[model samples]
Target: MAKIKEKLGRWLRVAIGGPMGIIAWGISGASAMAIVVWGLQTVALPLLMLKTASWGIWGLGVFRESRAKRENPPPKV
Candidate 1:
């Protein structure tokens, strides 16, 4: 009788605890993912904008240089 009660208690604890543990684990994982995504967006967005602007400026410089060279060709060596 004592052994049966002990087994039943352990089974009840497992039945109650398993789903709760799973739920807690899922919430923690989702929270961690949200934090990581937020951090990446915060840090990456400005950097991406800066890089795009830099590329645009560089492209304009190249275009201007090409146009100038075409207008004033260097004397042939």
Candidate 2:
């Protein structure tokens, strides 16, 4: 049980952290593009899509967490 819990915790952390890291990277990339390119029109759609994907990844993590909680519920105090 302890090992299972440890593995689950690591998985959850990765699931949540992956999207967050991607989102942060995307934000920085977009900012750099905006500053360097002098306009966002060219890369706007792609950047938007990247950000959207990050959100989707995050939603998946949330869904997984909720499902896990529903399946395993916390122990009583």
Best by TM-score: 2
Per-model RMSD to reference: 30.8, 6.3
Cα error, candidate 2, residue 39 (Å): 4.4
lDDT of 2: 0.64
Find the candidate with the highest lDDT and give its number.
2
Tens digit per residue, CA lDDT, model 1, 1-77: 97679557655544333444345445445545655777756646554555455445445545554455468654553
Model 2, TM vs. native: 0.48
- Residue 38 of model 1, lDDT score: 79
**Model 1 ranges off by over 4 Å:** 1-42
The digit string of per-residue lDDT tens for model 2 on 19-73 reads 4545655665665666578667766777677667766656665666666666886
After superposing candidate 2, which stretches have Cα over 4 Å from the reference?
1-39
What are the lDDT figures for the candidates, one per model? 0.53, 0.64
